[model samples]
Target: FLFSLQRKSIVAVSFIAAFLCLIIVRLTNEVTFPLILNCFGQTSVKWIPFSNGQRQPLRAHYGYINVKTQEPLQLDCDLCAIVSNSGQMAGQKVGAEIDKSSCIWRMNNAPTKGYEEDVGKRTTVRVVSHTSVPLLLKNPEYFFKETNTTVYVIWGPFRNMRKDGNGIVYNMLKKTVDSYPAAKIYVTTEKRMSYCDAVFKKETGKDR
Candidate 1:
């Protein structure tokens, strides 16, 4: 009986180990496959045949939609440096170093004009929140007209970003585009926002 019990314990341990290995494999695949796909420009977006029987490339980056062209945002970069507005970078003086990256991402309304020594002067992309839209509008010339080359990605709750003529932020963005045709602006799709929330929950074991 003792021998049988010992055998059972060993089997249980082996089973647990196998389960852990499976979980690790799944996690690794989830994290790595998306990156691989992005690197090869084979993201979730797929090519579809047009009405004229011609296949068109529907390029997208994680479900971000370009407001002007009404197509998916197509962007690629070798390296990206995300500059935060946190005070921790006050004396870092990493501006020149950050500027060396192929792409520089900034958060909403974070002005680099005054803090060019710590934050970088160049901005390839700017992720803005719905609440910060008005703040940006306050300086429309600086944010939309001046930085026309920079891509703008906006994120917010569905109510504020919806397109049924009820989304305040969406309407504002539409007006901004009409005002500055050269501005490159994109908004996160509802599905993409849900996916981000799912990822956050999966990683932290808590709802985002």
Candidate 2:
């Protein structure tokens, strides 16, 4: 009789544990989906003009150049191609095919000058990594001043792009724009960056 009772107790405990697990899973699903849905594929935030609290000095020798607000690209094209920095495309001979697309997006500091036969010479947008900012700054005059029409979207951590005056990369980019006066560089907003982190955490169930 005691053995039978112990068996019933074990079965009861197992049933309760499973029931709790199911409830926890249901609750997590309910909360996780709403938060992640808002961040799905969000790469940048709106470019509203920064207030005094959010703005900082460009620290130019001539004068300060304030970061201007701008809107995201409103492409009306039906076909778009995202070109990644992959070595497989080194000799793919797809330059003509890539150029045929209505719009193109490139990642990081991938150049099209030498690899035009494989990656095409046209670039609608280049999504730059934060680490490449310093490199671009080295030749800011040539890259930003000379090519004033190329649009660049840079993404990085909060410390690199923050407006609290401590953002090293942000200040450097501001200086570049101040000198060039016509360079087009867009830094991802903090909100979008946080949302991206949240999405990553939710998907991985760990902090990014």
Candidate 3:
């Protein structure tokens, strides 16, 4: 009877080992961390498509996500997605504040046409009421001069944002003070400088 009991235990252990081996084989896959965006009271996600410059259709997949929401948003077949250069901290501010302001502004205001639109770029949604951003220089009086002479504010003699952003903003002031016809254009980082006819950091209307 004792010998028979030992045999039975051996068989049970072998069966359990085999079951674990099967599970290991089935679960052998690379684990990939997913990117998530928390919005409103739920989580929303969109698939990003890969582009090849040629007029070819892109491919995408619904990234893995977990959230509890009553409604699921329908996704389009296109892969064109916009994201900010900022990191996680900035993203929180964007969703909390920027999104609200942008909603109201778009409803009552019209988007400006004829300006060169940025590719693969996004704007932070503004939320706080009447929290106006001083779009132009500290002193708009100098940046926009009303005179017989045409003074163009050049963009960049500096290239990298860390390396060139301050130089670009500061040199605009220098050009106005020096009374120069051609100012350095700092907008483009193709690492080249050119002349401009009329330039403004941002345009604002009296109505706004």
Candidate 4:
């Protein structure tokens, strides 16, 4: 009887040790995975769990917020291709290849209509500066009306992006959305813009 009792105790101890190990591993991943992703310039990770026990990828709260909806932007892409409008891409002819990516990101007011051979035709996200807002508005029919499905993430100082009727750029964007209701426009929050500057400074050791 003593031998049986010893064997039972051993089993219980092993089970307890395994459970503790699992908890440790879970905690480690929750903490370390986000740091790893941040190093790669990803604003958010994909392992966040919901109340229903479902996992969903989430962008940082400081990231883009929808202009019309006033809600956080929720977007996840397995592979993203950032298309740059550089002279080096003149002869690349990689439009088809870039289009294969799950998401394509562009900067400023780069247009891919004529240069579709080098830059992909589809734009998943466009990061525009306040100064470039005029360039985009130059052809609202092309940028806002036609590419209504593309998400626009504008970054600017609080002075230019504020919504209190004093922000010039914000007022322009508000008018754009009013004209084109289908446009998906988001502006980076002040916190997000500052976070971006911090990341840039950390990476380049120079203020942006």
- Stretches > 4 Å off in candidate 3: 29-92, 95-208
How does candidate 3 score on lDDT? 0.30
CA lDDT, candidate 2, residue 172:
83
C-alpha local distance difference test of each model: 0.83, 0.68, 0.30, 0.83
**lDDT (10s digit) by residue, model 3, range 46-158:** 22322323232212212211111112222233322233333332324333333223112111011212211321112221111111112433444533344312112222333
Q: List the RMSD of every prediction in angstroms.
A: 13.6, 16.5, 20.4, 7.2
Give TM per candidate: 0.70, 0.61, 0.19, 0.70
Stretches of candidate 2 off by over 4 Å are 1-66, 70-77, 204-206
A best-first ranking of the candidates according to their lDDT comes to: 1, 4, 2, 3
Give the range where candidate 2 is weakest over 10 consecutive residues by summed lDDT: 56-65
Order the candidates by TM-score, highest first.
Answer: 4, 1, 2, 3
State which candidate has the highest lDDT: 1
Predicted candidate 1 versus true structure: per-residue lDDT over 57-92, tens digit per residue: 434585898888888886666789999879898889
- Which regions in candidate 1 have their CA more than 4 angstroms from the true location? 1-59
| Candidate 2 residue 17 C-alpha distance from true site, Å | 70
Q: Residue 113 lDDT in model 2?
A: 80
Question: Candidate 4 on 1-208: residue-level lDDT in tens?
Answer: 9999999999999999986776455434454445445566664544553443645455545478888888777787889999986878877999999999988999999878888888879999999999999999999999889446899999998999998999999999999999998888999988988998899999999987
Please report how far candidate 1 places residue 118 from its true position, in Å: 1.0
2 versus 3: better TM-score goes to: 2
